[model samples]
Target: MRTLIPTLLFFVLASHCHGQVERDKALHFLGGNLFGLAGAGIAKQASDGNRIWTFVGSVAGSTLIGLAKETVDAGQRENGWDNDDLAATVLGGVTIGVTIDLFSKKDDKRRLRGRYSKLDLKKKKQFLQPTSEFVVLEGKLPSLNTLGLSNQQFVVE
Candidate 1:
């Protein structure tokens, strides 16, 4: 019974330590996400929506920060190195980039719709009207603008 008690105590202690380590890893991952998101936001504001600059700043900043953390942990000799943390940082940055791209696409669609809404029927027709130059279609080629069907539903073989 005495030996059993000691074994149980040891197991409980080990589980507690394991839980603490997992919690610490979670915190680090979340911290990386926040840092990467901030970097992305700052880059977007600074570069005025330039995708290349935003991506570079966000991913590089987060990755560098993660590497720095690993370096510090290495010096401490306790946590050693964690590749998962670095991967999480990169994933966070990519998430931000994808989010920004989605927003940009949404804005583009809105602007296009608004522009089209402002145009009258005559203007809409005029916009799709092709030039007077006629070209002969000898081959079975699909041409959307050839039959005044630009932006309209048409079948293509």
Candidate 2:
């Protein structure tokens, strides 16, 4: 009975700690998404070469961030069941990040914002837009535009 009490206390503490880490990681991913959005446009604007490099660097940065995220996730997994907090954080961050990129267009930010605002992430296994040409005024979404679609949906892995 004495040993069992201590074991219960230890588990309670461990679970609390794990929950905190998971929450933190989710927030971090959400932040990264916002950062990526802003930086991606600036990178694109610098110069064609610089733009390419920026994207490359951003991808690397994102990968590193994901690694960091997974490490944090492992901790939570060790404690208890997976929670939605992590996904919420990543999605929140990505929404802001992608929006930042979308809004960066000098001429078409307003116009695009109107169309962009109409998009809904709730769709499953679908591309965001049916036709995506001119996502921004001048910028490109080759996949969206060439395919003549706007909204794109993604399958959750």
Candidate 3:
């Protein structure tokens, strides 16, 4: 009975809102990208630069924040829930998250000193020409291995 009243009220309030979902706003795009960048950065720092966790947390956090914004918007008569804004937020979050991960991986060799060495241009050309790709050998750090990426081959095109 207690739960039912709030649920009923929620529906009643929700039913009052009606608006065409707004998209293509500059503010939405900028806010989404910023949110995404912050989300990924925070997650990466908190997780100590673990790739998977950073990506997952970034996307999840951005999406949740977007939804929370929409929930508040839903009650506002001037602006209802905007699916398009949420989509933009999620996209921005994913784009920045993946980009950060890629950049981190590219720079990982420097961080994992002595495990992998620099490849000469000639040798690099040889490897590049044959397969049109080169693999990044992730070092066997105990923590990284726990993430299942240790010694994994990440192809660079």
Candidate 4:
């Protein structure tokens, strides 16, 4: 619930959003989103969870790809370079980068770590101790008398 605000704000504040919802622009946005997400993941791994590097990587990757795409389009006769498309792409990248940054709080990590530590201790204690009341009987079935049901009747087909 708390994370939804930034996402909604990003869509509202995206650049060059002049009520022109073309398929080409949508595709550019999607492509930028994929590239940005990939970049953020790679950067997070390379930087060992550095927040700034992850955001930079996402924006940089999307911008680079958007530029390359526009350059290619400029070379073609039918599809010329469109600034709006590039803006959409960059916006997608920024959206993802900001989302990652917001979610990756150090305090959240610390809280999770503390919770997991307690859980780990409990798990270790459970594994190290054994209950004497429970017994394992492999390949053998308990008779009615052993089960404390001596008066029970059984029918076999």
Candidate 5:
């Protein structure tokens, strides 16, 4: 629900730039989205799920790619650089980055809540306790006697 507004706003701004529609801007926008997604994935893996790095990586990647494309276009004789194209690319990046950051933050909050909710000793003990399932055949498993179950009552299979 929170993401819908920003997404709609991005499209509205992108479509209505300078009161004219530019078909070339769509390619730039799609390119930015692709690069931004790649950057977000790389950042998430490198930063161990850090939201800041993920957001930064996404925006930076898109902006940098857009800048590079504009620079190249400026050097050409027939094809010139367009700010609107670059803006569209950057907007795409911002949209993706914001969405990723929002989702990641929600996940972080959920994890935090889960951690705090497991503060009870009984709950912790139950969570940490091993169940009566064993697959190892060569090594000795932890004693079940300490858990109030006799060794004879335990089955190897």
Candidate 6:
């Protein structure tokens, strides 16, 4: 019974939060992008209004979800119940949830890093492109952040 309670708790949480990957991804993206946008939004608000509270909310939600899943996983391990699919499914769901949320928000301004980066595109250019038009490439990471990006634009018009 030592492990059973935690297992059940995890199950309940997961069941209630099933198919959350989009939401999780959305939240992840939203939280990451907030730093850029908050400067314009919260700058004029009262002292109590800042980006910190939204950030805290995102952290608590994501952490609680991970902790619940991990706790059940640990309990299951004690019984030798190896279920990789369940673990993977939960993670996938959370990721999808975050992704959905991230893209759902409207942002007039988005940061485009490294002009030569293939993924970087003008907002209008991206809108006209179909989803399947992307060209994936394998690349090695540069050794250091100090390196300057090539001036030629790699992204297709």
Alpha-carbon runs more than 4 Å astray in model 2: 1-26, 34-64, 75-86, 106-157
| Reference-based TM-score of each model | 0.48, 0.30, 0.49, 0.56, 0.55, 0.22
Q: Candidate 2 residues 70-104, lDDT tens each?
A: 66767794643233544543455455445444544
Least accurate 10 contiguous residues by lDDT in model 3: 111-120
**lDDT tens digits, residue span 23-120, model 1:** 65666667667777677666655555566666666776677788888888788855777787777666766666566555553344232111212324
Report the candidate with higher lDDT, 3 versus 4: 4
Q: Give the Å error, residue 13, model 1.
A: 31
Clash count for candidate 5 is 0
**Pairwise TM-score winner, candidates 2 and 4:** 4
By lDDT, the better pick of 1 and 5 is 5
After superposing candidate 1, which stretches have Cα over 4 Å from the reference? 1-21, 104-157
- Pitting candidate 1 against candidate 6, the one with the higher lDDT is 1
Structural RMSD, model 2: 22.6
Candidate with maximal lDDT: 4
Whole-model alpha-carbon lDDT for candidate 5? 0.74
Clashing pairs in 4: none
From the highest TM-score down, the ranking of the candidates is 4, 5, 3, 1, 2, 6
How much lDDT does each candidate structure score? 0.64, 0.50, 0.64, 0.76, 0.74, 0.41
Residue 149 error, candidate 5, Å:
62
lDDT tens readout by residue for model 3, 1-157:
9999999998887666423324454455556667776666666555555667767776877787788878998999998998887787777778767776666553453321121124322232533445554435585434545557764565456
